[model samples]
Target: MSSVNYYSPEGLQKLKDELQDLKIRGRAKAAEDLREARDKGDLSENAEYDAAKDAQGLLELKISKLEEIVGNARVLDETNLDLTKVLIMSKVKLKNLKNNMVLDYLLVAEEEANLAAGKISVKSPIGKGLLGKKAGDTAEIIVPAGKLQFEILEISR
Candidate 1:
């Protein structure tokens, strides 16, 4: 069996929509490019045809990978999430012990992570360290730069 991937509802829907677009419009456009390239010149000397074929190959590979991900994806509901500890989909407020800086982060799946939006992937160093931590608990996370300490202030849905 394939490994199950967790996703939020919106993230899963976005993936499905993208896959649909690639299979429909993307494939059509690729085929059209190939046809146009083939009409341009002799097969052996046609660089455009070769390039088109390469592009089509890459597109098919992307579609196949996306199909696999969508097939195994499980969308998680956030309403019933546990607030006892930091987990996927948890909104956590932390205070940096060393610098006294406060930061907020939402733990989410890798595909749905957007640092600019304050969402961090559970697989990240700080996210992994913060997982299973309760309020007021201190976490000493080892990041790429070095080890940093953070105190969990709160955990919510």
Candidate 2:
């Protein structure tokens, strides 16, 4: 019932690396912390012990999420992509119809989205609305503020 998500090669690799780190180094760190806390004695009253256990639980949750993402992740081969329509990893340039302002954003997964880097999540309202659009197309996206019109100026790999 889980849908597969498309990720760029770099994004997929990053997820794999983080998952490995959490399974290896993260587990080791948690064990060490727990052992050290146990050495301090008084289990029920030991704040350090409680903290370590809480951390371990959080780490396990993170590892579980990483496993799920990796399980459903697919790498997008840029060349094989259809350039005629917008999709994940496509660099889209658009003009704000209201202000005639131009903005360029690369559609990416939520984990890889970084506004400072011009990467926007495909889950975002604007990105979702822009999906499957071509250059010279106009997309009207509904945001928390209201609907905004964006004219696609360019689409590139």
Candidate 3:
């Protein structure tokens, strides 16, 4: 069975849009490539044709995987979420205990995680440690480097 993944409404919409694009534009491009390759030479000796066929296969595989992901995705209702504790889609303000550096991160699904954009995957070590933690609570997260401590300063939607 495919596991359900939670996404924000925008994220889910983005995924759906990508799937639609792949099914239409991507398939069209693949077909055109095959046609161009087939015109090059005979099937037995045509390297271009073989490469085009391989490319088409890979495109189909990508489309299949994306379809599966979109089928299993559920959008989270931001309005119904609890703001008192950290959870998926929560914007958390954290204070590093060791260095006392204040940082902010938005907890999101793995697919939407972008550290540069201040979004972190809920499945990540720090995200897991912050889960269910309320403001003023301290979390000790074990990372590859070592154990790090952070105090939850605030939680917001």
Candidate 4:
């Protein structure tokens, strides 16, 4: 089964760009490495050639995986965002029920999620719990530590 993931227009473009880079620059670099390794001598015991071939294989696998992600990515239009509830691409302000600490986060795709930027993946425990919730609603998220209760303070596009 394939996991359906959402992506903003910008995010999708980034994926395309990365794919292009891998197909072009990455392929060229791998070819150069392979050529240099082949010049080093015997194929049976050439560690450099083996390593280079392995790297090429891994690079190709990465490229294919990235292509699959791009092919399945759905771009979400922000102009039509429904602010009545929390959903993908929604920026939410939440308060911890126990500590009263407020936090802001943008719920996005797994690929776009960045904890340092306060962006959470829609598949994350907190994001999943927050989905479809409205302001004043409480979300019960199950994390590695335990159940975390958060009050939805605000929701925005």
Give candidate 4 misplaced runs (Cα > 4 Å): 1-3, 79-81
Candidate 4 global TM-score? 0.95
lDDT of 2 by residue, 1-157 (tens): 5678989888999999999999999999999999999999899899999999999999999999999999999887777789978899999999999999999999999889999999999999988999999999999999999989999999998
TM-score pick, better of 2 and 3: 2
Residue-level lDDT of model 3, residues 1-157, one tens digit each, is: 7898899998889889998999999999999999999998799999999999999999999999989999999998777777899999999999999999999999998888999999999999999999999999999999999999999999998
Clash totals in order: 0, 0, 0, 0
Q: lDDT at 16 for candidate 1?
A: 95
How many angstroms is residue 99 displaced in model 2 relative to the true structure, after the best TM-score fit?
Answer: 1.5
Against the reference, the lDDT scores of all candidates come to 0.93, 0.94, 0.94, 0.92
- lDDT by residue (92-120, candidate 1, tens digit) is 99999999999999988887889999999
Q: What would the C-alpha RMSD of candidate 3 be, to one decimal place? A: 1.4
Q: Which portions of model 2 show Cα errors greater than 4 Å?
A: none
Off by over 4 Å in 3: none
Provide the TM-score for each candidate, comma-separated: 0.92, 0.94, 0.92, 0.95
Compared with the true structure, the alpha-carbon lDDT of candidate 1 equals 0.93
- Comparing 2 and 4 on TM-score, the stronger one: 4
Question: Which residue pairs collide in model 2, if any?
Answer: none
